[model samples]
Target: MIGRRACWGLGGLVMAMAGCGPAPAPQAADKPRAEAAAQATGAPGTAGAAGPSSTGGASSAAGGVKADEATKPAPPPESAFTPVAQIPEDLEIRLHPVEGALLVSTPNLTVVEGEQTNVATAVGVLKDGKIDFPERLRVPGWMVTVSGVHGRYPDQLDLIATGTTGRTGVAEHYALGAKGWDQRVGDAGQWFTGVARMGSSLVGLTGPTMIGRSRFVTLRGPRVGLTITPAPRKGECRGFDAEAASRYSEAEVRPEAFGATRDGTALSYGRNCNGDNAVEVWKPGEKRSTILPVPAPSEEQTTDEVRTLILPGPGDGEAWIVDRGVLRYQGGEAKKIDPPAKGARVLTASAAPDGTLWALTDDALFTRKGDAWEQAPLPDGVKARDVAVGSDGAVWVAAGGAILKHGGASEAAGAAPGTIQLQKGPPPKPRENRTLPRPGGPKCPQNLVVLYTFSKTAPDDYDFPLTRKALKGRTEFSPARFVVTRDMGQRFLAAFVPTWDLAKKLEERIKTDVRGSTPQIVCATPEVVRELKLDLKTGEVAK
Candidate 1:
C-alpha cells in the first residue's frame, strides 16, 4: 500500500525490498557507514537525511507560466527511510485486520552503495496493528536480504539487514542497534536468513556462521556455549554439535534450541537435548537443574514446541513445563488445574507465587484454585502470551507483546469485587515510634520488611494498632521492605517488619491464626524481589 516494490524474504512475515537488486560480485567487502535504519515501532520517528542528491535537480521551465516552479519538482518526498517503531510505548492498542501484507521497511537511493541498498521497504504480515510475528519470532524484523532472501539472527540489540538501494540493484547490509529509533550502522554487505533472541545476545541462523558448509554454526554471543543446525526454512533446531555439546558434560549432553528466562540477576536457559527430549532447566543460584523429560516438539510441531516455557513461581523451589495442554513438573505427573474450555484451548499458562495457577485462552484468562477456573476481568481486543505473579502477588501478564500487570506499589490493574488486588498508598504519616527514618532509595528502612493480608478497607481499617497487636513484641510496621501495598477491593494490608527472620516467624503465626483468611504476604529487598519471576495465581517464585 505504501507504493513500493517489497520483497517477502523467509516466511513472508519478514520481507525486504529495495529495488530487488542482486548481491554485488564477490571482491572487496563494502565499507561500513555511520547512518542506520529507521525505528522499529509504528510511531513516527526521525533520523538524519541519508545524503544530498536527495535534492532534486531543477528541470527546464514549462510552457508560459512559472518555469522555476516547474523546474523544482517539489524537492523529492523526504525519506532516507519512513519513520517506524521498534516497540511502541504504553498506549491503547487495537487489533486491526491486516491486508494481504504490510510494508515493513524501504531503502533510499541516497544511502545506496555500489548499486546495492538492502531493503528499502520489505512487506510482511501485520495483524491487530501489531507486527504479529509468529510465536518464536515475537521480535521479528532483524533479517533482510537481496537477489535471494535469507534470514539471520545476529546478537541482540544489533543485526545485519540486507536490502537494495532503490536506485541501484546492489545489495547492502546495515548493522542495526535495538536501542533508539536511529541506532543503526551499515556494514560490509551480506545476506541474513533468520535471527532469534537468546540471553542478551542475538544469534544468527545464517550460512556464514556454518563451519565451512556444515549446518554447525559457531555464533558470536555470550553463550557461544551453544552450536545450532542452520535449517531455518524448516524451522527445525536440534542439539549443539558434538564439539559444542561437550561443554555441558556435567549434565545430560547436547542442549539445543536454548531458550532463556530471567530469575533475578541470573539468567536461566531451557534446552531440549537431541540425545533426549528432556529439558534441563537451571540458573546460577540453583545447585541441580530441574530436568523433566517433557517430549520434544515433533517435526510437525511449531517452534513453540522445542521452546519449553520454564515458569518459576514465587517462594516455591520447583519449576514446571507446559505440554499440549497439561503441566509436567520435575517430580509431578502431567496435570491442569482446571478442565479445558468447552471449545477453546489454552494458549498459555503460569503459576502464582501463592500456589494458585492461571491459564490463557482465545476467549479469556482464567485463574485456577483447587481445580476450579474463574474468568479474570480484562478488556477485549487483546490476547496474552504468558502470565506472571509478583512477589507481592501482583498479576503481571505478557499480552500482545505488552505487559498488563496488577498488584505492586503502583496502582494495580483490574479493580472489581472479589478479584485479587495489591493495596498501596503514600507512606503513612509518622506518629510516635512509627516515625522511623526513611531508607534511601527503594528499600525498606533498616531491617524492616512489609507483610500483607486481606482487610475490609486497606486505608480505613489497616489499623497500625491492630497490626502491632497481631505481631505482639515484633517491630514490623508499614512500608516494610517485604511489602509495598494496601488495596481496597480485596481489603489488602501492608504490614511492616524489622527483620526477615522475625517477619517469617510472624507470618507463620498469622497464617495459622488467620485460618480461613488466607491472607497474602510479600517482603524482600528490592533487588532480591526484582530477580524473582512469579506465577500470577499462586505466589510461587519461578526458576
Candidate 2:
C-alpha cells in the first residue's frame, strides 16, 4: 500500500499494542512479532510481517514500567519477632551449686573467707547467718569430730595429728594455712585416745592403758603441755569397772566435748559401747567432780561398756544417758523413764534450747516437757542416727546417708506419717544381698510382715479400727508369724511414726485391740527417730 518503510512502521505499532492487551493463543503467541515494539522489547520476529523500525521506543518504555513493579515486595508479618521469658537462677541448698559461697569451718577457725577463692574441705551455707559444725579434728587413722557451734566465726584452724608407725600415738600439731599444712606439734606416744578443748586450752589422751594407763594431758598456748593427774582412785563415779574402760577406749572425746564457758563450770558426757552410761561434771578451778551413774541391768552390764552421756546445759544440772533399753535422766539421783516400749531402745538424746529433753527411741521420738513425755512425727524414709536442734528452732536429724530437717516449732512428740512396710518376696539369703526398699507405693510380696499405722486427729479415734473397707482392698498382708526383735521393731517404729500424736494414738489403739498381745506400739523421741534411719514414706526400717 505505502512505501516499505511506512508499512513496516505501521506493522510495528500493531504488534506493540497487542503486547499491552491479553495474551494471544499459544500457537499464535509463539510466532515472532513483526512490529517495531517487538524489536525494541527483544520479542521474536514473524515471517509474513516485515520487521519494522528495529529500534522500538514505545515497547521499551512499557517493559521498564513492568520491571519496576516486580522489584517491590510486601513487608514481613507483624509477629515475626517477640520477646521470651528467661529462667532465673535456682538457689536451693540441696542443689549444691558451685558458684554460690559456702561456709567452711574447723575447731579453731569459726568463719574465714578464702582469699581470692571459695573452696574448703567442708563447705556449707550459713543458716540464719549462723554456722554449726558437727565434727572437726582429724584423728589420723581413726575418726574426726567437730562441735556444732552456732553464731561463732571461724578464724583459725589447728591440726593435731596423733598416731604411731604401727599403733596409735600423738604425732604433732600441724598448722593448716592458705598455702597448705605445716607441722606445728611433734610426736609423743602410741595409743593416744582422747582429744578435747577447754576455752583456749587443749587436752589430749596418750600412752597405753597396759603401760600404767593412758594419761590426760593439757596443752596451754602454743607449746606448753600439762598432764592432768587422775584422782588417786576412782571416786563415787559408779561403773568405772573394766567394762567402762573397754567402751571408753573406742569412744572419741574432743576438747569442745567439755562444752563452752559458762559460770566457770564445765559439762561433758562420756560414751561407751552400751550408750551414755556415765555423766561427769568437772570444775577446773575447784578440782571437784560430780558423777552421775547410768541405769543398766546387772547381768547385761559390762565393765568395759562406757555410757554415752549428753549434758543439756550448765544450768540444767542434769545429763541424759542412753544405756541399752533405758533412757535415764541422771543428776542428783538416777531415775529411769520407762522405755518407749518393751522392746524399743533409746538411740540418741539432745536438749533443746527451751530445756525440753528430746530422746530418739528405736521407732519413735519422745519429748519431755517437765515430767510428761510427748511424741512427734519423723520424716518419711528416714531413720535417725544423730539428732540435734538448730538455733533457729529447726530439728536436724541424720538417717542413713541423708540429713532431714523439720520446720515445726512445737516440742510435742510425733511420728512422721505412714506405717513401715516390709519389702516384697523372701528375705535376701545374705546380709550383703539385703538392699533397703525404696519409698512410696510398691506391692509388697508375701513372707514379710507388713505393719500399717494410722494417725489420731482426735480422742476416741479408731484403735485398730479395721473396717471391712480398710481390710477389703489388700491382696497380700504381712505375715504375723515372723519373729520381731526389739532392735528390729525399734527401727520399724522410728521409720514409720511421723508425729507424737500419731505415735500416742497408735500406741493406745494397738494396746486396746491387741489386748497386750503382739506387735507392741513404741514411742520415740525425735533424736532417736532420726538415728534408726527409718524410712518415713514406706514406714520400713533399714538394716
Q: What TM-score would every model get versus the actual structure?
A: 0.30, 0.37
Candidate 1 per-residue lDDT, tens place, 72-141, comes to 2222222111111121322222111111222122122112548785322322223333333322221223
Q: Scored by CA lDDT, what does every candidate get?
A: 0.30, 0.30
What TM-score does candidate 1 get on C-alpha atoms? 0.30
- RMSD after Cα superposition, model 2: 35.4
Which window of 10 residues has the lowest lDDT sum in candidate 2? 18-27
Quote the positional error of residue 88 for candidate 1 in Å. 9.9
Quote the lDDT for 206 in model 2: 38
What candidate 2 gets wrong by more than 4 Å, as runs, is 1-166, 169-264, 267-280, 290-294, 297-307, 325-331, 407-543
